[model samples]
Target: MTHLDHITVGDQQVPVVTTTSLVIGTGSAGYNAAVRLAGFGAPDVVMAADKIRAGASRNAGSDKQTYYKLTLSGSEPDSVRSMAETLFSGGSMDGDNALAEAALSARCFYHLIEAGVPFPANHSGEFVGYKTDHDPRQRATSVGPFTSKSMVESLESKVRRLGIPVIGNCRLVDVLVDDGNVRGALFLRTDVGAARSAATEEEIVETNVGEEPSPEPTGTLVEQLAKEPSRFLLVRATNVVMATGGPAGMYSDSVFPHGQWGGAGAALRNGARGHNLTEWQFGLASIKPRWNVSGTYMQVVPRFVSTDAEGGDEREFLSDVIDDPNLLASLVFLKGYQWPFDIRKARDGSSLVDLLVYRETVMRGRRVFLDFRSNPAGALDADQLDEQARVYLERAGVADLAGTTPIQRLRHMNEPSYQFYLGRNPGVDLEQDMLEIAVCAQHNNGGIAVDGWWHSSVVDGLFPVGEAAGAHGVYRPGGAALNSGQVGSTRAAQYIAAHRAEAPEGDGFDAVATDVFGRAATLLADAVARFEAGAEDNTGTLITDVTELMSRNAGLVRSRASVLEALEQVTQWLESYPETVVVDDSSRRSVNRLFLIHDILTSQYVYLHAMKDYLDHGGNSRGSVLYTDPDGDLPWPDQDLGLPEEFRFVLDAGALDGVTQEVDWNGAGEPVFTWRDVRPIPSDDDFFENVWRNFRTDRGVPARQS
Candidate 1:
């Protein structure tokens, strides 16, 4: 049964929604959780979303977005243990989560397939696969550029069929906790319009200067409420599944969909432990349409160009770095497969292209673009191509077209990729104009800590799946994230179905809701008061500033000094956010913007703190980020590439690989950091009878072997 009650917030009455299970995203993981929960005898399940169809799962894609799974059609030897070992080998990954992900991968993949996500299969009815980055076996598959999108659509269809209610336009402001456990969540209903009609014009008065701030007058409360033109929604759920995606707003150079700032801030504020917060995945992406420019986009070998702020001063930047035309072209080709920047490959591999792009854009403050209209250094002759590049092109049937322009080869090789740009709004005619690019933040490898059953490490009945869960460690295979989201969500649903299917017992909710919403109201009131007193609205500016700060200091490149400085700045921003942040107007949009800024700042502070702590623990460059080593050699130091000293990084040669760093934001003071050994993969009884007996006894959800 769904109960709609009311709670008093200041003088306003906020609606309270009660449900058995609440899924806090409309992404693949969230929708799947809802579908699975409903299917597994859960009494009631509802979904809450910031915006329907407005997330990375729907908007983000690459040339051929991959989904990693166990090898299905190959003659090659493979097992659950082998797959788990491969995932765990990524370093810092917990062996048990890896094992769980590996064991359930096929079940989850087939679930997607059964739900109508059309993963390709051969005539023999075997799902074909390919090798992706960090994968030794051919365990990757794709339906197209929008694998996650397809998954979301299919799972959403299932959710709809199950009659699961999805409430959109709900921005999670806080996760309501009671006595250390999750009670529910507080949200600002963005769709509510002009609900504060009781306030009169006389009540909306400006205070005389910033005199000792008195208790808000009835009018002041109404006036603050009026600005929002919205209402608060208090949702009390037995279980809250947070699949709110990554902290996209944390980086200015991000490919995450616009307006999907993520709900991690809410979880973190509620004392959710963060695991591997320092592991982020960065890659090259087009800035305009915000899509990963991996695979065929790079294999075509488009000309790399740089320009001044006004788009003038056109120069071939890569040509300036590498004189060998074939080597330069080969590296670009390699970038197709080795898309994300790996530290091991930074010095003498495809990742050097990433560094050059960073140098031209971030370091030199020039705009970088892929000029598909022209060939790099007037390229010609497929015979002159490196063997790897030539053979790949020959197999792709683009070898003979290599002498032609990049666009021509792209069209002949992958027409869909060439047409993808033309299909975008304000589309780029790759045959004519240059496509601007950046070293974009694509995903976070770490987030809220969880156990084998995808339950939050600290909060009972709180599960963080998808990118929100810090399931991955230092590195992951391409498409592993998609699989991880599926498997993790499935596990959470199974556990909830068997154990926590009933509504939470409570009397603590009233107190918790009052405390949480009261705090939120004060923060909002402070913002409005600051705005009324002539404080300039820096909401947009602050977001840009924070993103820029993160991208610069805590992005793919890091140093002890830079991280410490950035962490200090974030700390200052957090301290002053309420008092200094000004809402442009009373519109719910503006109010939400203020809250978003705080959330972004809160996330940035936590992330930078994790980075600072990691560096403090003698962490060196690994995964997507490179920690600068003053003693290290620069890329092609023998050449005159004008590479900055900061680019000189020494890779951490597996010293800290066996351990993982976790951070806890206790909602005050400095975030505490802890390092722990990764949980080893479980070797449980494989005898069918023993497993079946435990499975049956435990209601189909076995206890965590670890």
Candidate 2:
């Protein structure tokens, strides 16, 4: 490979290089794969993102980041079959990937602990587990609110010890592909420019230092930002693993770190097959400093209240709308297990909490807040909380909090829940004030499609782990994303190692580089042309439009008319890309933002289109992506999927597998979605297995093959 751009590394110019395998995104998944590859002695490299904890895994935290695993050290006699059964349950969209994930979850969990992740465990040497989301077993555990962050910390330490080459502050902007095999990736070193930008920011006093600084430019008032200086390194790799997470920050109402768009477009542009792009997960969280307030936060059952701008009538809003106050309090307790908004629970009081919160914040004119200093109207009595809530409180040893203030109860219970916030440099005292909440796009259960081993089925030599891979369907078990990332990345690493020597690097290097270069050049030329033509900067406007559209049309609730209108607007923005103004001349931040716009638009194009198709093909509500036709009523008053008894609109999880969408780029690089039947991962209970084996034997295969 030739040197595209040069950068001084401690006064030495490091040229572009080649590696056997390249792992993009330095989050948990990417780092895990890189370390595993290094363990196998198959040379690999990692981009130590702008900051060690820049991506979603490191930055985002919640009441408790659940880490779901098997019985392991727990008292319950849980088996892999039982684990897989729970994994496929809960109306989570189908695929046999969950079965494989379940089979591998135990090993992955232990792997993290071995790598120095400090998960909570009992003195008897058993890792403690708790219930989360849609799990029937006590398979979830966490270390405060930083489970993902702790995993990242452990993985980073291991990577450093192994001496796997890390190009810190680099971004994998594009991948070089020839004959459908990934040749390498083009990475831009943004650290140098970032440091320069930071030095400029140091002159300002009112800046959030050490944080992902706001997208503030430091240039002359009249001059548009010049193309910020950068060092582009094109690494030629035989295998490329895109462990970057899903595109979560594309929407404004998101809990992900600012401007962190998962690099999905790099694969989409190469005509890679993307599955489940329509199935993103959303929930309630604090908006200012984004964080999920679930687990113990909800378990403590804080007072749900909202206030107007003037702050006159302090009201427990749920009591006003819901007829029964006891049911309202119980539903608040249920929010602990039912964190994500489930459509089937829409009418049921379980999911009504989310609807009322969203309604209070968005639909109604009020700012919703969860006050820990107080309790709900009738929460004084021990009988008010259901047996499940009391059981959890007893397990957490906070059962005595029946008559105490929510904060005092939380203090005796999960100290780290509040301590985690106070541990920040300029700490937050949750005891004093209420935490503002909003419905934000949290985890994405959708992304690039992969086979059982997590290798991209269409783009050979390309593996997508973590959120980058669409292994998750609809709703994930609370901490399953962490487990899935570990499992998927390890599988990707093992697959790459098994075939490392066989990868052909020299076969079509020139051809791959030519095409990648041409595409990049065309985009750059268009950008420059637009800048020269006095194009107005509509990137901000576009982001607002995209975020609001997704929030209103395709968010927690959806209607056909609203989605079609959103589609029309998104289409118009796509057509207006030529006239879009991107001020990159004087600022690299602007360039990054411009690139982010491109990435989001590309990913959203497929997402919005797939959603339209999903509703068109009689796809009803399941997880967060609820579809309501404007002309017709909801496919509701139905009961299935282990749903709460009070609600309607339960999507048939079994029927979901037969109705799936595949997004592929055409000759013009525009995505076209086609519906396909994906193989479903049936529950692997002992009885189901025997019957399935018998059925297979009845068909053709021998029973012993099972």
Candidate 3:
């Protein structure tokens, strides 16, 4: 057990302090909460986190717009009402009301614009829009491809302008809750050495913002020490908003390194870390699990097609000859590559290909090449092509090859052909173009379930926003994530503001403070003992283990066996965690230790809970498949049981304890599933209407009829 020498209260090391609201994350949602609360005249809003903008908001591709089209896509006509209903149907929905309120406050975009966010605009000054894969309309509005960065900058600027004090690099150790209400949080500054040595260099770069060169001699060690241990800042509040990004740490395998990938889906797993709040709510907008589905359905764009010396179209011949889906699938798997170009067979038996710029090469040494040699040179927009070329070169550390055809040839020659064409004479190049092929992790429609007002059922005074909250049903429309964040945050702010004034002062604050400090003391003692014993038992290993387990068992493809395996792995990790301890030189006053511990525990709980629910729901193929074997076969445990078709209802019911109700597929058959419940549709509208209706009612907005 850990022990504490003292606790700090105000300037004195005593015990506790209280405030009006506590905003728990530094991302878009947290910032929104603080700013909104301040605007609404809430006193003393405190924003806490290990790092702000380090969550999904910072890592997002920032496709700005309401993904109304994707939400409405599918065979059955889906409306706002149906969308909301499905979001809430699984009891995982939270913040429906908040989302609705945010929809009403669409002018928040204008507010962001005023904050200097550079949204893409057209010649007429209206927002420019583009279409995405699942979207039914051109709703995505981007500022080049770095929209997430731009938005983060704008939000950070606005937060500073509002005079909101942010304690960066500080991690919350524990939430102080009393009588079921949040009082404050325990915190610790993460010791620089505690993070992996490799991360120290990155940390330095991140923290050296706007520092000028020093001409004088460097300061002494004593001088640096005097400035060390920056004040342990804590803010007590009556209300708290959890805007931590999604559970990326929880699903580390599926998510790309921070800021490397363009999709928001992979970042949703970060919310898993925040699920530890004892009194906080948990819910997520449901979204279609496409990352595990269409994401694996590989397509390629041929950059340069080869032709024979006779000048016959070699590219045409290859397209005409290679029309087998099995061959294509095999090629994609063996080459460890996905095509960049959209290849389609024409009615005349030739291929119509839309060549795109190449992004990254596959392991098979096949460079993504775009075949533009056959087209008139410069027929395509030169500026757009140049921009893409620059982006690829910068990311891959390649030199300028603009307007060079040989570069395309070099890339194409290095690529391997499918087994079927191994002995065939590869043709000569007919066209040379750059092709960008990226196999990115996209879409995490799964998350903490939320209602119209992003609050958790398990805990009050806790709200989740952005990708953390699961509101998008089975499939999220392309632009809805942005809408969810903006609207969810705004609505959460409204709820906090409205309730803060009426919240009765209680003993929960003191009790919460005591509990938090007690836990911190225990952690500190554990660290000290670990140090004394000269043992290295940190939470990172456990976290990594969980991540590996999730990747192996709960990723891309899933089956009964894999889900069960994941559940078993989670249980084993939990059992092994208690024997582990993190050692840090940083004082107990900091929040680093608290943050790490909370994150690890929360991650485990949320993932296990989610898997439990997912397993409980036994249907045909729904959401993303998590456990498909290498041979691409589903492995259900009871395949030969020959149970009634209705028995499969367990799959659609989500996490079933004794309390939660099962999905009523019989009543709302059309939207929830395609075919019969026995043969589930890959994607269907199971609970959209109910989820949307709740959202509409929560926001006091008129629900759109289906």
Best by lDDT: 1
Residue 603, candidate 2: Cα error in Å is 0.6
User: Mind sharing the TM-score for model 2?
Assistant: 0.84
- Give me the runs in candidate 3 sitting further than 4 Å from their true place: 1-17, 62-102, 191-234, 256-443, 502-506, 537-540, 582-598, 627-706
Q: Could you tell which candidate, 1 or 2, scores higher by TM-score?
A: 1
Error of 2 at 292 (Å): 0.6
Model 2 residue 428 distance off true place after TM-score fit, in angstroms:
3.2
Best by TM-score: 1
TM-score, candidate number 3: 0.60
Clashing pairs in 2: 66-479, 225-585, 225-586, 226-585, 226-586, 227-585
- lDDT of candidate 2 over 144-168, digit per residue (tens): 7777878887887787777665554
187-298 per-residue lDDT for model 3 (tens digits): 5544332333334311221111243422221223213322444333334556556666555544543322241211111111212112211111111110111011111111
Can you give the lDDT of residue 137 in candidate 1? 96
The per-model lDDT (C-alpha) reads 0.84, 0.68, 0.40
Ranking by lDDT: 1, 2, 3
lDDT tens digits, residue span 1-706, model 1: 7566677767877777788888999899999999888877888787888777578897688889999999999598888999999999999999989999999999999999999999999999999999999999999999988798889989987877676777777888998877668899998876664333243221222111232332222332223333444357788898999989988889888878675689788888889999999999999999877789999989988899899999999999887878788888888999998999988888788899998888788888999999888788855567887788899998987886445788988888788887777776447788888999999899999999999989998888899999999999798999999999999999999998887888866688888999988888888778878888888777768877988998988888888889888988989989987778887555656676777777888898888888888878988888998899898877666776767899888778888889999888878988899999999999888899988888778866865442
TM-score of each: 0.93, 0.84, 0.60
